[model samples]
Target: MNTIKRNRKNRLSKLAVVALCTAMLAACGSNTTATTSTDSTAAATNTSQTTAASVQTASLDLSNSKVEYDEDDAYSDWNASEATTIKLNGTTATVEGTGAETKDGSVSITAAGTYVVSGKLDDGQIVVNVADEGVVRLILNGAEIHYSTSSPIYVEEAGKLILSLPEGTNNVVSDGTAYELADASTDEPNAAIFSKDDMTINGTGKLTVEGNYNNGIASKDKLKITGGTFEIHAADDAVMGRDLVAVKDGLFVIDAKGHGIKTTNDTEGEEGLIALEGGTYSIESGEDALHSTGGLLVSGGDLHIAAGDDAIHSEIALLISGGMVDITQSNEGLEAGSITIAGGEVHVVSSDDGVNAASGSSDTDGAAGEMPQEGAAPADMPPADMPPADMPQDGTAPADMGQGGGPRGGGMPGGEGSSNNLLTITGGYLSVDAQGDGLDANGGIAMSGGTVVVNGPTMNGNGSLDYDSTFEMTGGVLIAAGSSGMVQAVSDSSTQAGILMTYPQTQQAGTLIHLEDEAGNAIVTFAPSKDYQAVYISSPDMKKDTAYSLYSGGTSNGTETNGLYDGGNYSGGTKVVSFTAASTITWVNESGVTEASSGFGGRGRGGDRQVESTQS
Candidate 1:
C-alpha cells in the first residue's frame, strides 16, 4: 500500500485531490480528501527580512522517502468506551486506568494502554514513562493541559506514542517559557508535546499548542501525522522530528519565531527528512518556513508561506511534484543542493534569488545566511546603508560557483562535473517576482516542460536568470525581464528558440510587452513587476528564421496568469522591433541583432556572465 504521489498528470491545482489520495494511501493506508483552504489573510507579507545563504560542499541523493505506512491511524478511531478515563480536576487528576497514578502536580502513566483525557490541568504535566515495547494511545477529548517549567505531554520512553484527537474536541496544550530539565546538560523534553519515541497524531479534531519555551511539538524519532488540525505558536521550531516528519493530511496555522516545520537529524542515515504529502498550511516564520536536513518532498497540498529567510529549504534534495505553493514573502524562496519541480502551480515573491540550487553541507546551513548560535535570533542581513546585492556572500557568487556561461558546457568546460548543483524543471508553472536573481543555480539547469515567468532584479548586480554552468532547454516557455546589466542568455545548444531584447532605457512597471508572430498570432504578453531594461522570451511558437513582431505598452484583454496573457486581444502598443529567432538564442537591441555579450555582463557578481549567440 505504499503509493507515491507522482500523479503529475493533474496539471491544474484541482489535480491535487488525486495526489492527496495517493499520499494518504502511502501514509495511513486510507484514502482521504485534501484539506480546505482558510480565509485568513495572514500570508500576504511580501518584504523579506533576511538574505539567502550561499553554498559550501556536499553531494546528496534526490530520492523520496518511501517509508511504509503503519497502522497508527486506526488508534484514533478506537472505541471510546474501552478507553480508561483520566479526568482532570484543576491541579490534580483522578485516573481510572490501571497503569496511571497521580503525584504532586503530575500524572505518570507507566504502561501501554488506551487512555481518555479531559477536563483541565492548570499547572501539571502528563508523563508517559513506559519501559516495555508497547504502543500507548492517548485520546484527547476536549482537554486543556498547561505546564510550568516542563513539557505538558512528555513521552519519556515508549514503543510508539499515539495522540488521537477525537472529533468535535478542542485540545489545548501550553508550556512555560523555561524548562527545568532532569539533565540540564542535555535539556531534554523542551517542547509542549515532546516524545522520546516514534509518535503519530491522527483524527479530525483540533489541537492548539503554545510553546513559550522551545518548540510546539518535537519528537526524537519519526513523527507522523495522518490527520489533525493544528494551530501552533512557538518561540522555536513549530514542529521538529529528529528522524522524519511525514504528514498525510492536516490543517495547520503555524507562526514561529524560528523555523515553522523542520527536521534536525543531521548525524547520519535517512533521518532529517520531511515528506509533506497532503495539507493546508499558512505559515509565518522568522526563519525558513519549511526546512529539512536531508531531503524534502512536497507532493500534495496547499501552502501559503511568509518567511523572513528562505521559504522552503533542504540541505540535500528538494522535490515538488504536485501541489499549489504561494511563497508570499521570502529572502530566497526555494534553496537546496538540488531542486526538481515535476509538477505544481507555484508563485514566489522574494527579495533574493527566487529558486536557488546550490551545494551546501549541513555545517554551512543557517537562517538568514549566518550560522546561528544556540538560542539567539537569526542575524539579519545588510543594514540600511548596504544594498542587498552588494553583500559579501562568498558561497553564492557565480564566479566561484563554476558558472562559465556558454553553450559548449553549462558550467564547467564541456559540461563535465556541472551536475553537482542543479535546478531541474520537467513540468510546472512558476511565476517569480524577485529583487535579486530570479532563477539561480550554482552548477547547471535543465528544463524540458513548463512555463516560467520571472520579473527579476532591478539592481545591476543580479540577473533575471543566473546560472554558473549551462542551461539546457528542450521544451517550455520562459519569459524573463530585468536590468540590462548582468544579463545572461540561454546557451546556443538549446533545442528551443529564444531571444533577448535590451531597451534603450528602463521600462516602467506595468508596462506591457507583447510578442506576435507573422500570422498576427499573439505569442506572449507580460507586464514586469519592476522596471526592466531587458526582456527575454522563449516559446514553442518561435521557429528558426521565423519573424516575430515585438511591441511595448500594449493592452492585453486576455486571461492573465502571473503576467502572461493568453487568448487576449492586444492593441494600442507601439511596435518595437521585428526580428527572427535564432535556432537557439538571439540577442537584439535598437541596432538590429547585436552580439550576445556586449562586455556588460562581466562587471557584476560573476565576471564570466557571458553567452554565445546566433545571428537572427
Candidate 2:
C-alpha cells in the first residue's frame, strides 16, 4: 500500500536529442556555430513545512548548478585578420580597423578583442565602451542596427559580452517607440540589445529583434544562449537576465509583452535562475513564459508556450529532467514552489491549475520578473463552486454535504499556506486540460512512474484529482476525466491499482473509455476532451482477482495521440462494467461495483472513502 503523506495535508499543487545530433554535425562541418554545452543543474532550493513524516524526495535534484564556460568562451572560427573591422555605414560608421570610433552617428568600441561588425546602422549606436575589465567579442557579420532614439546595441561597459552570429549571417536589431534616455534616472537603455556586463550569444546566425523601446535581450550580468536563430518582438522582456538565463542551445521565436525568458535576480540571496539546457522554444506571452526568481531547471529543451499569464513560473524550484513541453495557453500551467517531473513530454492547457503547487503563488501570480504596469489584465481566477443545487443524480450519492456531514464541492485539506506543496511524478508524459485543478497539489502528491492524463473540471468546484495532503500512485498510468461533484480516489496507501467511475448522466465529448483484459489486453484506450461526469483509473493492469472490462461508446481504430489509444481494433463501445480488482480502490457505476461515499471531504486516506470492487 502507499503511505507517503496521504494525511500530511499541505496542499498544493525533450529530449534534447543526441546533443541535437552533435549540434547538427557540428553546424555542418564547422562552417561556424557550434558551442554545445547544456549539462549541469542542481535545483532543490530548500523548502520546508512538509510535515507528515515521510519524504525521500522523488526528483528535482540535478546537481549544484554546473555553470562552466570560458576558454575564451569557446570561440567560433574567427580571423578577419584577427580583430577590429566595424564598417556599418548609413548614417555613418566606417571604423576600418583599430579599436573603433566614429563619433556623433556613433560606433564606439574602445578596444579589447575581435569585432567584425558589418553594414548598416541607419540612425546609429554600436557603442560598447570597453575599459579595464574588457572582454568584448562582437561578430554580427551582416548586422543592421536602427536606433530611433536610444539603444540599438549599447553595452556601455563590458567585462564580458560575446555576441557572435556566424554561419549564414543575418542580424538585425531595432528600437523606437520613443526612448531618448541614456539614464533618465534609471531606465538607462531599455533593450534592443542593451547589455551592461555579462552576455553571450553564439553562432549559426539569423537573429532579429524589434523591441519598440523596451526589452529584447537586456542582460546586466549573466545571460547565455549557445546557438542562434531568435526572432523576438518585445515591448518588454523577451530574453532578459539580470543574473542568469542559461540555455545551451537555441531557436526561439518569441513575442512578449513581458517575460518570455526572464531572470531578474530579485535579490534576497540572489539566485535568479533559469537553466534550460538546450533549446527550441516558441513563446507568445503577455506575461510569463518561463519566469524564474531562483530556480527553474529544465534539463534539455523544446518548449512551446502561449501564456497570457504563467506558463512555467518558478519562484523557487521547478525541475523537469529533459524537455518537450507544450502549454497551449495558461493561467497556471506549472507554477512552482517545489515541483519535479523526472523526465519529459508534458502538455497542458490551463485556465488555472494544470500542475500547480502554490507556494507564494509566484509572489502575486504574475508580475514575474516585474515591469508590466500599464494596462494590466491577468488577475481574475477564483470562481469554482457553483454546481450543487442539491446534487446527487446517481452514481451512488453523498457528494454535496458541506455543513457538518462534510464533503462538499471540492476535496478538503487543512490550513496554513499548505505545507511546502511538493508534487512529484518520477518519469514523463503528462497531459492535462483544465479549467482548474487537474492534478493540483497544495501539499502532497507523488507518482512513481509516468503517464498522467486529465481533462478536468466541468464545474462543481474543480477536481479531477485535487490534492491537499495525499495522492501517491506507485507506478504509471492515470486517467482522470472530470466533474462528479468532486470525485477523488487513490490513497489506500497505493501499491498500484485504482478505479473510480461515476457517471449517471453527462458523458458526451468523444466519450469512449475502454479498459479490457480478460483475454484481450488493452487497459484504458482513452478519449475525453471535455464533457465527463467522472472517471478515474490507475493501472499496472489492475489486478487482485483480475477480470476487468469497461467500455462505453467506443470504436477505436487505434493509434490516437493525445486522446490516448495505441493499436487499433475495438468496436462500438457500451460494455460498462465487469470488475474484480478487490480493493486498493475500485468504485464503479452504470450499475456495477459501486458503494462507498460520505467521503472526499478530508480523510479519503485509510478509509478509502469510495471503493467497491466486486462486480463481475
Candidate 3:
C-alpha cells in the first residue's frame, strides 16, 4: 500500500498541469457554449472555463524571460510538511523514504520532493538525478558533505532545484584536489556544488564552501541567491553562473585565486548577465573582483574589493544606479565597453587607470598587461617641468606625431575601428586618486549631472581627463588637478564655464588650494593626493567677467565645498593672486605670463615666466 501511494505521488507531481491548461485555453474561445446542455449546466461550465483561462494566461505572462526572479512564479508552491529525511554517517547512508536510492558511497534522489539531509559524509556524494520535469528542494540541517574525487553535491537532471539552509544551521560542502567521473558521457562537475539547471539558494543559516578543484559554486543556467551568510574560498571563481547571476540579499566574504563573482557565457543573443539588487560583499581576488561578459547592473549594494587586476569589468554595458563601492587596490578601478552611472557613491585608488571606457573585453586569465614591478613606477614617465623626450618644447607637433597634433600614444590611437563606446554620467558622486589617467574614454563623454573630483597622475604621460571624441558637459561640477602636459577643456557646447590655470611652482601634497568669489565666498577647495602644478575648475556658479582669487594654505569658514572639509572652508587664506575671468592663464615661476583671455570659449598658449634672483 505504501509503495502504491509513493508511485501515485510521483506520477501526480510529474504532470505538466500548468502547461496543459495554457494549451487548452489557447485552443478554445471565451464565448463558446455547450448547446446540448441545460441552461444551468451551460452557465456553470462557461464560468469554470473562464476562470481557468484567466489563471493560465496570468501564469504564462508572469514567467517572462527576465534575469530577475519572481517569488510567486518560482517559490510559491514549496511546502516543508511533506519531506524525506536522509541521514549519513561516514560511508553509510539511510533514507527514511522510498524516493532516494543509496549505493556504495553515493545517494541518488530520483523523485521530486522536499528533502531534509543531515550528518557528515566523509568520502561520499549526494547526486540529484530526477525526472526531466522534476522540482526538488534540499534543506540542509547541520549537514556536512566532502568528496575526495568529485563534487560533494551534483545536480545531474532537474527542471529546477532549490538548496535551503534552515535557520540556526551550519552547512558545509567541500571538494578534493582531484576528480574522476565514473561515466565519460556525464558532464563533469568542477565545483563544490554544481548544478546544470536553474538553481536558487536561500535561507537564514551560515554556509561555507571550500573548492579544492575549481570553483566554489557553479550553475550552468540562472542562479539566484536571496538570503544567507556565505564564506567561500576557491581556486577559481568563488561564484559563477553561465547564464545569469542575480543576487537580492546576502552577506558574502570571498577569497579567490581567480575572479570573485563572474559570468562567462558569450552566446550571440543569450549572453550572460549579473544583477545585484542588495548585498554586502568583501572580496579579495587575484583577478577581477566582479566580471561579466554580457552586461552588469548594480542597483544597490556595499562592495569593498581588493583586486590584482581590474576591480569591476564588463564586456558590454555597465550600469550603476545606487551603491557604495570602495576599491582600495586595483590596476584599473572600473572598466567597461560602455559605462553609465546614474546614482552611486564610488571611491577608487588605482595604479594604472581610475575609470576606463574602451572597446574590447579583457582577458579573463589575468594576463592582459605586464604588471609593474614592486616599488617601481611605470616606464616612460617624465619628471615635473619636463616634456617627453620626443616632444618639442615649443608646443609644436613632431614629425612622428599621431593624429590631432599630439605625440604618438599621447591621444587615442588611430585605426582602432569606429568605437561607439561612451561614458555617460547622469548623477553620482565620484572621487579618484590615480597614478595614470583619471577618467579616460576611447569614445565621447556626456556629463549632464554629477560631482567629480580627480587627483590625477603626477607624471606627464597621462592626463586628468582624456577623451577621444567630443566632451560635452551640460551640467555638473568638475575639479581636475594634475600635471599640465596634456590638458583639454570641455567643448564649447557646454553651458557652464571652465577655467584652466597653471601655477608657477609645484605645490606639495596636503597643501590647500582654494578659490573664492569677489565677495570672499568659497567656491572650490581641494587637496591633491600628489604634487600638482595645474588645476581645471568648471561649474555652473562660475560667471563670466567675474573676478576670482586663488589662495594657498587656506582654512575655510562658510559653506562646504562639495560636502568635503579637506581644506576647511575658503573664507581666510594666504592670498596668492587674483585674476578676472579668462579662457586660459599661465603663471610660471612667480611671473604672470598672460595669454589670450577669452571668456570661456577660447584657446591660447604661453611659455613659463622666469623668477628674479635676489643677492644675499
Model 3 regions more than 4 Å off? 1-67, 72-81, 182-187, 361-381, 385-418, 557-563, 566-568, 582-616
Q: Where does the lowest 10-residue lDDT sum fall in candidate 3?
A: 1-10
Q: Rank the candidates by lDDT, best first.
A: 1, 2, 3
Model 2, residue 184: C-alpha shift (Å): 24
Per-residue alpha-carbon lDDT of model 1 for 1-616, expressed as tens digits? 0011011011111112223223222332122222322312111111120111011111111223354568765434666577688898899899885888899867898899888899999999999989895888988989999998899999999988999998889999999998988899888988999999889999999999999998999999888898889999999899999877888899999999999999887643343778888899999999999988766878889999999888998766677877899999987789876677767889999877789776433112222233222212223322212223431221112222221111112322322222356677767789999876788775656676778999967754457887654566667789999865456666565678887777766788899998888799888889887888787898888877777788899698999887788885999998877766544566666445553222211212212223222223
lDDT of 2 by residue, 541-610 (tens): 7765566778888689989888888888889777877767667666677666655434543435344333
Displacement of the residue 423 alpha carbon in candidate 2, Å: 20
* Count of clashes in candidate 2: 15
Task: Provide the TM-score for each candidate, comma-separated.
Answer: 0.80, 0.37, 0.78
For lDDT, the strongest prediction is 1
* lDDT against the true structure, each candidate: 0.70, 0.69, 0.64
Error of 2 at 46 (Å): 41
Which number leads on TM-score? 1
lDDT of 3 by residue, 1-616 (tens): 0000000001101113243233222211221111221212111111222332232222222122134454622323335457888898888789987689889877899898888889998988999989865888888889999998998999989887898877788999999988897775854798899998878988878899999898999998778888788999999899998877788888999999999999867654345667787899999998989987656767788999999888888665566767888899987788765676666888888877788766442112122133334313336545645545664443332344421122312122222311344566667788888776688765545666778888866765566776554456656778878765555555444556666656545678767777777897767777677777667777767775566777777565544543344434464457765766533222211222233221111111222222221111
Could you tell me which residue pairs clash in candidate 3? 556-569, 556-570
